[model samples]
Target: MKINFDKYHGCGNDFIIINNLSNTFPKDSENQIKKICNRRFGIGADGLILINYNDKFPFEMIYYNSDGKISTMCGNGGRCVMHYCYSNDIIDNKSEFLACDGIHHGIINDDYVKVSMSDVNGYEKYNDYLFLNTGSPHLVKFVDDVSSLDLINISRNIQKSNRFDNGVNVNLVSRKNDNLYEIRTYERGVEDETLSCGTGAVASALALNILSLINSKTVNLDTKGGLLTVDFNKSNSKYTDIHLSGKVKKVFTGILEL
Candidate 1:
């Protein structure tokens, strides 16, 4: 089978995007996606994404990690999908889209996309970490020095720990300065420290708000790969109307063989 795919990146977290609205591919067949996203033996990417039309919204998206399992909600994936959706006329310049989590609205203006993610209604506290699910599960921790920690190794250990048996994406964050933070994330399915993670960034930013590290409607985040901005409204320590803003860039296009 020949699969048409487009390569896209939101802050250097690259993915192979496919428009599978026709349902030409079987619903459960994701093995090929994993093979294609393999770094060494296949077309390298952080994961694979499918943009398909749904009766509920302008479009629906399915996300898979490099492991090829249809995983949880993805932040950056949402932004990139909108970039293609609006650009391809699947939706107008601004529209509501549905992802794995729920209905999300976004505005796409050329290279910039402002995605409105779900509000966080709950939080789990730990001496060393804060746990939250923003569409996808995330474990946020603060380190003495962000530059000195190895995100991959630490995240792998935390993900496998009995504490979070289902596994969770891990974010190591540091307050770079007032109103700005630096974050490094280890994604679950990718099983490595991706250059950027939208949900992870959102989790970290919200955690900061809960911890009183920053108090503002919008937060600036500097990922290892690029820049991402987060906006939200808070009441009684709960955040709502969360939006992630960043440069969702297009890299190239290609056809994959299976």
Candidate 2:
């Protein structure tokens, strides 16, 4: 069996997107997706996305980490899917799409996609760091030297710390200017430093704001791969109208012989 797939990226967070609406994939396609995502043996990618047809939503988003397990919501992945839908006329330039977290309203301004994220209600403060879950769990800490930090080595220590059994994405943040932050993230499922982590960026930006580290309309995030921005309104320690904006472009398209 051959499965047609398209590759896309949001701020360097790449994914293999398969049109699963028709259910044309085999019963074990999910497992096959894992193999394709393998960096050493197949088409390397950060993750995989499945766009399923749904009656309640314009489309359904199913996400998977490269490890072959179903994962939670992804910020960059969401934008990638939105762009994929628009580029392929899955919906339009603007539409309501369903994500793993919930309903996401988005608009495509050319290649840049800005998406409204879910509301965040929980915030935990530690000795020197702030933590939050904006669709995905993250730990954000202010750092002095992000570029020189051994993110892969140190992030692993905190990412699976006993405090979080399920695990958490760890982000090292530094205020660049205004509301902009330099961010390096250790993803939970990915378990390594990727070019970017969308939800991690959102969580870091919001946490930095809560800590009074930066104040601006848009939080410009600099990641190892590319740049992403998070815009939102804060009132009484809560966030509203949260939007995650970044780049999503097509890499290529091909069919997989299964």
Candidate 3:
């Protein structure tokens, strides 16, 4: 079978997006999914996204990590899929879709897509690090120098430390200024350092806010891949109106044979 897919990216995070509205893709075939994401043998990507038809919403987003596993919500993936929906007329400039996390709303602004993330009720603090789930579970720590840290080894160690049984996306962030921060993330499902991570970015920003490290409600994040912005409203320790925005582009369309 030949699977037609489109490639898209938000910042540097890329995905293989397929239109699964007709249910043509065999989602149960984990091996096939893994093959399709193989960098050398298939369409290389950080993850795969399926835009499925939904009765309650405009569409449903089903995301899978490149490892061929159904993972948690992805912020960058959400933005890219929303951009895909807009570009393909699956939605207008704005849309509402159901994802693994819950219902999410998104809007397209030229090349930039803004996605409204779910509210975060609380977080756990361990020494200088903070842990929270912003669509996906994340462990956030503010470092003195983000670029100088040994990201892979450190993140890998903590992920396997059994501190988080389900594992967590680890984010190393450094305050660049009052409203801006630099971040490097080791995503859980991908099990590697990605160019950028949407949920990780949100978790890092919220963690900074919770620690009173930032004076602005809107936080700017610079990753190895590109720049992303997160805006939110906090009330009674609950974060609402959460929006993650960044540049997204459709790279190409291709057919993968299996």
Candidate 4:
């Protein structure tokens, strides 16, 4: 079988996106999905996304990590999906779409795509780190310099520890200024560090604010891939109207045979 797919990346977090409105792709084909995401042998990507039909919304986003397992909400992937929908004429400048987490609103402005993220009720403050769920669970730790740390070793140790039952994405953050910060993330599903992570960015920003490390509600994150902006409104202990914005690019389109 030959399957057509389009590739897009939001700040270097790339995905293989397929228009599955016809329900042609099997959601349970784990092995095939894994092969397709293989870097050396297949079309390399951090994950795969399917834009499927929806009853009440413009579309539904189904995501899978490179490991071929269904995963939680991915912020960068969500932004890429929104851009794909808009570029394909499936949605206009603004629309709502459903994902693994819940429904989210998206908007397109010039070259950037802004999406509304789920509200965070609160976070857990640990001795050295902060834990929160910004669509996905993440553990954020402040560091002196994000570039000097051994990310894989540190993140692997945390993953193997008893701290989290399922596992958690680990984020190493360094504050550059009140509004600017640098982040490096080890994603749970990906099981490694990618160029960027949207949900991880959100989690880190919220964590920083909770600790009073930053002075503004709007924060800029410098990921390995690119820069992303997170804006939110805090009322008491809850964060609402959270938005993640960044540039998304269509890399290519191709057909793969299986």
Give me the displacement of residue 94 in model 4, in angstroms: 0.6
State the lDDT of candidate 1 residue by residue for 94-201, as single tens digits.
898888788999999889999999989979975589999999999898766788987788777776677777788989898888888999999888988899999999
Cα-lDDT of candidate 4: 0.91
Per-model TM-score on C-alpha atoms = 0.96, 0.95, 0.97, 0.97
* Models, CA RMSD each: 1.2, 1.5, 1.0, 1.1
Candidate 1 residue spans exceeding 4 A from truth: none
| Candidate 2 displacement at residue 4 in angstroms | 0.8
lDDT of each: 0.87, 0.85, 0.91, 0.91
Cα miss at 163, model 3 (Å)? 2.9
- Compose the digit string of candidate 3's lDDT tens values, residues 97-174: 999999999999999999999999999986568989999988899989998989999888887776787778889999
Ranking by TM-score: 3, 4, 1, 2
In Å, residue 45's CA in model 1 sits off its true spot by 1.2
Q: Write the per-residue lDDT of candidate 4 for residues 1-258, one digit (tens) a residue.
A: 888999999999999999988899975788888889998999989999999999898899999999888888999999999988888899998999999889999999756999999999999865588999998899999999999999989989888778787788999999887688999999877789999999999999999889888878899999989999999999999999999999999999999887
Q: Candidate 2 on 1-258: residue-level lDDT in tens?
A: 888899988878889998889977666556776788988988989899999888998898888888777888888988989888888888888998788789999989988998889988759975567889898888888898788789888877775567888877888998677656789988877788888998988898788778777768578999877889898888787888899998888999998887
Q: Output the lDDT of residue 29, model 4.
A: 89
- List residue ranges in candidate 2 displaced over 4 A: 27-30
- Residue 58 of model 2: what lDDT? 88
